[model samples]
Structures are given as C-alpha cells and as structure tokens.
Target: MRKTMLPVFTVIFFALGWALFSLSNTTVSQIQPRTLTLATTTSTVDSGLLDRLNPVFEEKFNAQVHMLSLGTGAALRTAENGDADVVLVHARSAEDAFIEAGFGINRRDVMFNDFIVVGPSNDPANIHNLESASEAFTRIAQTQSLFVSRGDQSGTHQKEQVVWATANINPQGNWHLSVGQGMGNTLLQSSELGAYTISDRGTWLALKDRLNLEVLIEGPVKGGDLILLNPYGVIAVNPAHHSDRDYELAMAYIGFLTSIEAQQMIDDFRIDDEPLFFADALNEQPNFEQYVPQSR
Candidate 1:
C-alpha cells in the first residue's frame, strides 16, 4: 500500500508541475507585447521626428515598434524582403515602383518637407539665392565645386540625381564625392569638406546649428524650387505576399499616422521654432488609385 501511495504521489506531483508550467507560459504569452517592425528613412530618425512620434503610437497600441532606419531605397528593400511590416519613405517614384511591384499596398501621403541645397557660407558654387535646383546643380558642376552626394539611394539622393539629370550632367571626377552614408553623415562630410549637398529641410533644420553649412537654395516652401518638394508616404507590406507580417498592426499604424491627432502632432513638432514636417494627410483628398497598384 505504501509503495502504491508513493507512485500516486509522484504522478500527482508531475501533473501539478506540468500544469504550472503551462499556466506560466500562457501568462507570458498573454502579457507579451505585440511587436511591429518599421523600415524607414534615416531623415525621419535623424530629425528626431520618430523619437517624438513612435512613443505615442507604442503607448496607444500597447505594442512595440522596432525601427529599421536606413536610406529610402534600403528601407523599401527591407520591406520587399519581408523583414518589415511597414515602410515610411520619401521617394515617390520608388514608392510607386514598390507598389507596382506588389511588395507594398495602401500607400498614404503622410507628410511633406522640401529638400534644400546646403553648402558653405561662402557659397563657392555661387548658387546662393538660386530659384531652381537644376540651375544650382549646373552651377556646381560647371564650377567643379566639391559636391557631396548621399549616393546611398536615399530620397535626398534620388532628388539629387534628378537635379543632376535635369542639369544634363553626368557627375563624375574628383569634385563629385559620393559618400554612401545616411543624411546626417553626408551632411557632416559636406560640412567638413565645405562641399555643397542636398538635404531634406527637416534634417537641415535639425542639424544646421552644429554644422558650418547654410541653406543655399530653399525648397518651394521658402523658395521657388517646386522640384525640391519632398513628400513622404507610408505603406504596409502586402499581407498576401507575406502572411507572416503584422498586417493589421501595420494598417493601424498607417491609420494613426493619418489620423487628425497624429497630423496635429506632426504639425506641432518643431525644432527651435522651425517646423520639421508639415502634415499633409488631411489636407489632400485621397487618390484611391494611389493607394493600390495602377493596374488593379
């Protein structure tokens, strides 16, 4: 009888242990925060916009937002590879291409800040007060002034390429420096070299105090260069293409960004009295076709 009792006791103890372990696991699972991955441009991160914005979203949703800040091209590629749940970037043509390629969906215009040509205070290219970015590029090339390019396929880099193309000059030679770096580093390099470079206004406002560079050509907001208008978009990775992603959360994030509260936050966010980004989601009517691929 005693041996039988001992066996029963051992069985009960094992069962109890298993039950507790299961309960513990269930509790952990219930308490675990849902994580959403965001692949975005360095400008957003560098300008401290995300620092102000992400925390609000994270707290509101009780979720964790893991950010992968890179150049716009790299950010899009990250989503293309299914590593990110969503993307926030400024390159419209590339964003259109991503949607057309079926890697992303439901792209919504989120914000706008124009690109500015920044260079030494001396304005070696004599590009100061230029109303056209293309003309500025032409001057830079013609003078063979040191031009620092992001070269990393960032939105700023894409804009620079367009300007160079507009100027009809294939930039090369020692005067043209292609630094495959982020916006901040590229600006720092440009400052160090006293070379002219294009940067988004947000980043320029955020970092101009620390650098010796000054805005040579302002974007449309402050100047007449409409080509420098930089608009940002947010898109979710196509859930059908990658089912493992947090599509619901991605959409929720997009909703939050476009929401009135968030838009106000974007509008109110500034650095030293200079607004970093202007919220555009509410100001413009949604182009239904722009949300999806044109073919669809």
Candidate 2:
C-alpha cells in the first residue's frame, strides 16, 4: 500500500509540473511588445475615424494601440515630450514647426477636411451666405454677437486666429467667449449660447444632429466661399529624442494611414451620408502657403 501511494504521489507531482510549464509558455507567447502610443486630435476621436481604423492596424501588425486624444497643439506637445510614439494633427504651420524643432520626423499628408463657421439657425451675426470667413468674422465682431472660441491653442484655434487676423479685427468683449476646451465642447458651448464658432467639418457634421447650430459658412464644397482647407499630417516622434520611441510601429501606422485601403476608408467615413474627410494620400501635395496669411 505504501509503494502504490508513493507512485500516485509522484504522478500527481509530474502532472502539476507539466501544467505549470504549459501555462508559463502560454503566458510568454501571449506577451506582446509595448503598446504603440498615438497622440491625435479630438476631431479624429470625436468623429470616430480612429475607432474604425485603429483596430485594422492592430490586427495587421499584431500590436496594441493606446490613443491619446487631445487638441492638435497638445498632441504635438505630447510628441515633443517623447511621451507619444506618433502624432496625427492638422495645422500645417505647427507641424512644420514640430519637424523643424527636431521633435518629429517623416511627416506625411494623411487627409483633409475644411473648417466651417457654425452658428444658430437664426444667424444672429448674419454671417450665413458669406463667401469669406474673414468677412463673416468681421461681421460677428462688429455685431458683438456671441462667439465661442476654443482658445485652446488647437489646430482649430490656430486657424481661427488666422481668420481673425485676416479680418483685421482684434476680438474682445463679453460677446467673445474663450473656453479652453476641445472642439466638441466648444461647439456645445456655442450651441448652448446660440453663439457662432468655427469647427472642423467632421466634428460639426458628427455633432450637428443634436445641436441647434447650422453651417453658416459651408467651406469650399458647398461653394459659399472660404478655402478653409484643413489638412492633416502624421509624424513619427524622432527616436533621437527618446531612446524608447517605437519608431518602427510609428512608421507602420503611417504606412497604414497612407495606404489605398485606409484612404478609401477615410473617404467613406461620413455622418448622415455626408462625407467627413476627403482622402489626400494619393493626391499631390497642396500649396499650404496659400492658406497661410501673409504678414501685413
């Protein structure tokens, strides 16, 4: 009886050892590399573009994506600090500055969508039907109509400053409200106050259903007027700045973004059957200088 019990104990010990070894191997095999950090604008997150595209990237590369959604300015800053692996942002001037400062590398055009001035349907400032954003802004300033500004130093905010500068009006007063928030929040503030605000067409379209705001300036597409072309670019954080930077994964994301399939997905992204962003990866580089205001 003692001999039989000894063999049984030995078999049980061997079985437990085998089970532990298999479990250890499985855990090691399941362990993936560090998550790819993508710092991007709220517009992309708010519009659900990232949600649709990121999963495809993860599946293709066998990687995990950790998205940091912020204003473009904050996104760039995050990349600059080496806290992010890559950045997807608008504001070409800011992008150029980031690359010039050596915080980013291999910048590539990803996509574009124009900005629009959205306001109450009643059009308190009567900026509706205006061909020029500068002219519309001038009217808003003159009327002292309620205007909500993102004022968050985001790409949208930077573009808004350019519009104001073009109009040659220094916006100040009770009517001009500066909320240091994101595009979505700013739009909600504008809607709540029945004020006017500039917004990326994508976010505007996505949120328009629930808001009382109407597109006062329908960008170049509807032909009302301003060439408020908002182009987006993706840049990998320079590995020189951060030793742990996932440069390979960053390039993979860039490649995926510029691929024909991804570009088609961008073109297909729409709200209420209206396309949000136009694919530009296959298009020639646009003359961004023309969009920049010349110094007076």
Q: Using TM-score as the measure, which candidate wins? A: 1
Worst 10 residues of 2 by lDDT: 287-296
- Candidate 2 lDDT by residue in tens digits, 13-88: 9999999999877854585745899999999898899999998998899888999999999999999999999999
Q: Could you report the Cα RMSD, in angstroms, for every candidate shown?
A: 8.3, 8.3
TM-score of 2: 0.85
Local error of candidate 1 at residue 276 (angstroms):
1.0
Clashing pairs in 2: none
In model 1, what lDDT does residue 13 have? 100
Q: Candidate 1 lDDT, tens digit per residue, 1-296?
A: 35558789899999999999998788546757789999998888878888888889988898889999988999999999999999999988899899988899989989898998999999888998778889999999999999999888989999899888988999999999998988888899999999999999888887888899988888887856999999899999999999999999999999999999999999999889988799888855665755654455
For each candidate, what TM-score against the reference? 0.86, 0.85
Candidate-wise lDDT, in order: 0.89, 0.87
